[model samples]
Target: MSAGQSSGRYEAVIVGAGFGGIGAAIQLKRMGYENFVVLDREDDLGGTWHVNHYPGLAVDVPTTTYSYFFEPNPNWSRLFSTGTEIKQYAAHVADKYDVRRHMRFNTSVEGAQWDEDAKLWRVALAGGETITTRYLITATGFLSQPHTPDIPGIGDFAGRIIHTADWDDDYDPTGRRIAVIGTGATAVQLIPELAKTAAELTVYQRTPIWVVPKIDFRISERVKRLFRRVPLTQRLVRLITDALYEFFVYVGLHHRQLVYRRLNIAASDLAKIHRFLSVRDPELRRKLTPDYDFGCKRPTFSNDYYRVFTKPHVHLQTSGIEHIEADAIVANDGTRTPIDTLVLATGFDLWEANFPAIEVIGRNGRNLGKWWRDTRFQAYQGMTIPEFPNYLSLASPFAFLGLNFFNTMEYQMRHMDRLFGELKRRGATTFEVTEEANKRYRDRMSELGARSVWAVGNCAGSRSYYFDPTGEATLLRPMSTRAALKEASRFPLTDYQFS
Candidate 1:
């Protein structure tokens, strides 16, 4: 396991074991490439699902749209499936596709460097092992890294501290005082569960989130049988869900100012109505309401999130935390609240910490993270970068499509198919996006993003994770899912240079 010694070589090295990695492995196998391997830092296959087992964790999107279009699960327990079911689905797909054999769990990749003369990538692992591969596809998800607040005295806290990402399943909250920080999507799901058991619960809110009614219900056995009997029935449901998802993304978020601002307003009005109905206290509802547009940040669905605050034992603290003591959290207004357990529901550091998730030194000594920070974050069609030859970053800017990640994964799988097919047809060993093509695509994305709510709408007060440090919405592509799929297949092959 020396630094200079290579553990092995492969045709491709995928740096994740999540759904993205599983999909990539299946595509590679389908393309007659069996020498690829999938690596993950976690001990299990599911990425987010394996890392997060917090109470009340479930899919915000419907089950119909959240799964792979190719491998539909007919037995989803509910419209919004639980995290456990999603994890099981991941295992099923990996096993059914025979991709699990290619995965190496508890394997952390520290960095990767493209060897120009060798025309391959040298990936460094945490245990001092190197892996050489012709193509490097990083499927490290956007939410891989959790963001713990750098609040003073956090280290000195004597009480049990838990991050939702690193939740301890053994810990119970009964009869214990708890303080939860953050009000994001994860917090929206977790706060209600904590309110049920904790003797006293206090929520530290930095920013309010838009919460709508989650139309979740248990799927009947008859529906499951029908879905299994007729797969096309699920496809039709998927189509309808996808259409609704596209409409929301296009009208409510991407085209807020360009086509219809009223749609976004109507969405906000719906959230307000849901809030008004859920929480009877006007002041609590006011504190829970978001000040920005509906799509400024990602929204979540919950039936009891708003009602949790109305309980007498649950308190909502709007004043930001000053610092944490050993047994208490002090507010900015000099108010202190003592709690036995501290829960950090703060979300991930997307642009700052997790864009690449590992060091990538590409051709000509180009540092991917530093270059992105110096310039703007740009990737050609959100897959290939100009300087990074033989590389595909699945979580790259503009790669995400609509609300469902399956849409992004589906299109990226197609993109890989087309790109690799061209590589095989040309008998080339390496492929890098042309600089002109990358720039053209980046320009087009910027142009489209100018019309998005993140760019033009009132998002300053939102503290949206969608906006990067450069104040740009570099996460999601501003195009429809159909367009993304079409472009993935039909994009000019000349966009990349093969050698």
Candidate 2:
């Protein structure tokens, strides 16, 4: 259908139905802005929680801290809730706030181009449908796209090969030789569970991850009842958890020397101690040990990850992959290991920045992807770019707090509300961050990135998704969540051009 014939123009078009999108929708509704629609590529509302259904899939962060401040759930069964619970939480929030009505599921946005003359955005859809909007909010998260490495004979494999993101629940691995590639966050959680069922499990490790103890436990019925009865009790717990997580950010990303260094040292010592105690053989311990600093890459929390290595049926392969044979994976040393199932836990593609899964053309018909590629991926607080007027992106480069995404979404949605409120108050048709303002923010991020562990030290050798193709740390914001919220709250609207 034609751009004007498909659907009437909307005030705002949210390009996701994930946590960020739902949060944005709720905020818009609260702000008395109902002329918005959230379009999702998937048939369901939940984003990460909807797609990932691998075995042993659970949140690393505590349930209290990982949830939205405005919409807290008092019925969490565990400290670290499973993926299903998180998905249910997302659905609950969506239903409670009446966000589902405004959502168009199974509708993928192909591309978006700014109409300079009309002062509107023309959005193309996958099914030759189009829609127009005054404001475009790209809420597509970083973890939406899965990345599987292109190994030789990958397509020629006789056995079933599945990515963690696309796991089949019916495909039982019992009595099957399974080879799991990439030992990231997903691998750490799934390995322990897979070890219990698989006849033989081989973990292909490219790099060792720093795994700390996961202090997870079931929330007693009494505690749940208390939380439900006394809301302040739960709020206090969330506050404490937030503070602890913020401290982690301060030490790991910001300070890194004074108290942070000491904490890191202590953590490193504990990890070493844990490794020493967990792995019986010294060689195996050494192989499992991470040479880089604790916070160089994303730190995982798992009590059973190391314990699984002691199993007789489980094997850790440190040898680099040469290629994937028809029915086996060939090692760099010419050793071939046969496997029935190949599970790739390689994680998502974070560097692509391909939100909306489309080419976004802004002012002067300049492509957003090309502009980002040429000038390095950047945005004003990872929200607005210079040329992309009336465009705001959530879960973009330099926006992530590296801790709780729910907190980030809350802060970002608040910031958006303020921006939209100001636009309405000023009777502005469009708004965009000034080049000077964007440059200053970009410079500050670069300065902070230089001091981060991902940019220096042993992290140089660590193959982390935090760094983009240009070798710049563009994924995470090197700032505390509180600091980020304060900055977003207090940033001058004068830095933005309202027209």
Report the number of the highest-lDDT candidate.
1
Per-prediction backbone clash count: 0, 0
Q: What is the lDDT of residue 153 in candidate 1?
A: 97
Worst 10-residue lDDT window for candidate 1 reads 1-10
lDDT of 1 by residue, 396-458 (tens): 988887579999999999999999999999999899999999999999999999988888888
Least accurate 10 contiguous residues by lDDT in model 2:
1-10
Candidate 2 matches the true fold with a TM-score of 0.97
C-alpha lDDT score of every prediction, in listed order: 0.91, 0.86
Runs in model 1 lying further than 4 Å from the true structure? 1-7, 257-259
What lDDT is obtained when candidate 1 is compared to the true structure? 0.91
Against the true structure, what is each candidate's TM-score? 0.98, 0.97
- What is the lDDT, from 0 to 100, of the residue 102 in candidate 2? 90
